[model samples]
Target chain A: MGEIKTVIVVERNYLMQAGLEAMLMEIPGLMMVKTFTGDEVSLAGHIRKQQADVLILNPLALKEDPIVFLRKLKQIGKMVVFGLMEKETPVNLQSHFSHVLNVSDSKFDLQNKIRSVLHQDTRPGNHNLLSKREVTILKQVVLGLTNQEIADRLFLSIHTVTTHRKNINRKLGIKTVSGLTVYALMNHLVRMEEMGGATK
Target chain B: MLINKNMKLADVIHHDYTLVPVINRFGIHLGFGNFTIQEVCKEHNISTGFFVIILNAFHDPHYFPKERLQSIRLNILIEYLQKAHTDFLEDKIPEIAFLIEKMPGECLDDRKTYLLIRNFFLEYSTELKNHITKEEERVYPYVLKLEEAFLKGETDADIKKQIQDYPISAYEAEHENVEEKLFDLKNIIIKYLPKPKSDKLCFQILREIFSLEKELNEHARIEDLIIVPKVEAMENALKLKGFGNG
Candidate 1:
């Protein structure tokens, strides 16, 4: 059990909304806040007021072009906006959404996707995501060193450095150097001087 | 984490220590600081006003106020964002390039195929770089120019040629997601491509991609959520004041 992610579903189809709501009941780490079938909430403030962490909806319910509405929702930054699309829309909704659920994906897949999306949702415990070795590697990474450079500096082989780096990223679930640098700085693994992105 | 100037600087570090860079931006240095944030910043010639807004913004991005935009220095925010773009272009992208390049030599995969994959990534990376470059060259300068004009009490009639035709909203409509292409690349490697001859190297690159995704997401967040909103609000205010044509 973790911080239950508050979710609001707004699908244009009642059956679709009901099906999603039924699935939501089985999905752990998520609590339903509101479910609407149609004619609800074109305003960002409605969802913001719910203090929701994720919105699962067909943008048609929002009464605008789905793509444009998704952009507006993203710009609001109130929560993770998950787009519900049927028949594979042409837009790369992934660009605007945390995850886009095609109706074709299985219900099981929906549960899995929701879990993965909420993986970094800042739960109460288990904040320590890196091991000692991983922490050392992360420090090197933030200092703007390549894997090869980090390997030489640590007196480790290039292969070993890559292995450590891989495990570190896997454990922490972060992908970019900038992301790791931010995490490292947050966790005190790296200093301000180490961050390449830091402004002078 | 809640922040107040009177709170021990050391305490804030303990709460979310990643703020080292955040503080350093305000010229606060390491090695001392039983002092209040205000005292330390004062000694270091940092503005408490600037320091406070940034601190609040970092600690709780959701709470960043449109109201604060008018007071916070646009130059500091823009400069910081621009430098971050450079860091991505110069450091992270090339680092990924090197990792991808090394795969061909170490892996048992056909050299030609590996080179092909590497080239594909380089091209995608080139596109991403261009996206960042466009934002820096086109959008940022316009915002800076707008800020300068607003502060000087200039009207739309005065600087219509400068930027009345383009708005920050236009850029937001096409903002980049640092994770998007990398997400495609990762799926290709994991699901579509043949098993990597060196899984460690592959995963290492994936890690870098994740890092880039996270970093870029944060960067985009700062721009999209904070800076863009701030700029747009300023533009709206100036327009309403009969300074600029909407």
Candidate 2:
């Protein structure tokens, strides 16, 4: 099972608020923690106090400037701010929200959108994701090949091999050979039997 | 407010007890009834200004007094940094290892995950020790030598060759790998770990990792902001003195 994320819904309309809370509860990984009116005092503060992982709010319901308010909430930390939108809603929310969900969005659409947003936020920036060449080098590393050995086998220069290793470390967030091996095992880049005495 | 020399020693610790290790590195001990930072430093024979600046820098990440740090003697700065390295190796690393070593026993059903986490940490610590060893064995000695040569306004043929061959800037890249690995180590535990039977132990491991991370960051900041620029200035001075010539 994945990590559970606490979600708070902020909508002033009674029916919409209840509807959002119910739908969010049905999402497997999300726990619908609380509901708040749009103009609640220190709404951001309350969300933080609850340690919410996602805050779904209607921009039309905000008492203060939505842009300023959303930006402040973003500063609080890793929580995702999702805009609950209508057909013709505030334009500025696009910059602030991880994703915008229309009030008329089906329950299935809502779950998919929120799940994808959470998924994307959980990963490090996509720009640093490993390239195919880097992944190849990482596999060689997991197989217990030194830079020179890997370079010789792959018909690349030692300098090029070294650079690839550094990029793999940066992309995967692990540096040592053992750490990379564990990562490969967890990701199933290599089978457990292939590890042999390396991990032992 | 930033801690100053006149603040009571007790108050400083009260504000941030995590700084106790930072204070201890200066050869200062606890058990002062009620002494100001200045009085405490005076009694310990430590430079009060340097002590206060370190305290402030560690307490608040943004409270770097770069000019003041640059003005400090390199040996004094290096000695303080060396002590921090010792604290990490001798104290912090072992303490965290002790906590993590028991985790496998606690989560026997998922022993492989616990063992891998331990292996990951051990690998990180080894890299960290190597990083410190490189600084101590190579970089710090060279920086001290450079400072000595700059102060005397002349360098021998060997020191001069050393300057042109391996400048201070060459050592800067070594820091990045160690820091990035430590970050990945933390993320693995926080995001990727299978559920351990002992939540408390896992939480404690994270707490230690965070403290170690914070101290290492401050250590890097001092080295980058204070030591790097100082050495760069000395290197440039020697170059002006025609030390760059083969």
- The candidate maximizing lDDT is 2
Q: List model 2 lDDT by residue over A1-200, tens digit each.
A: 34567788887787787788788777787888666666444456656555567888888788898888887887666567788888676565565676789878788998898878888766544645678888888888888888999999999999899878866764555656777777777666787788776552
| Model 2: lDDT of residue B131 | 87
TM-score of model 2's chain A: 0.58
**Docking model 1 quality class:** incorrect
Worst 10 residues of 1 chain A by lDDT: A37-46
Clash totals in order: 9, 0
TM-score of each: 0.52, 0.64
lDDT of 2 by residue, B29-110 (tens): 8898699999999999999999999999998765766679888999999999999999999999999999988887774347
lDDT of each: 0.68, 0.79
How high is the lDDT of residue A34 in model 2?
A: 66
For model 2, the stretches where C-alpha displacement exceeds 4 angstroms are: A1-141, A144-177, A186-189, A197-200, B174-176, B242-246
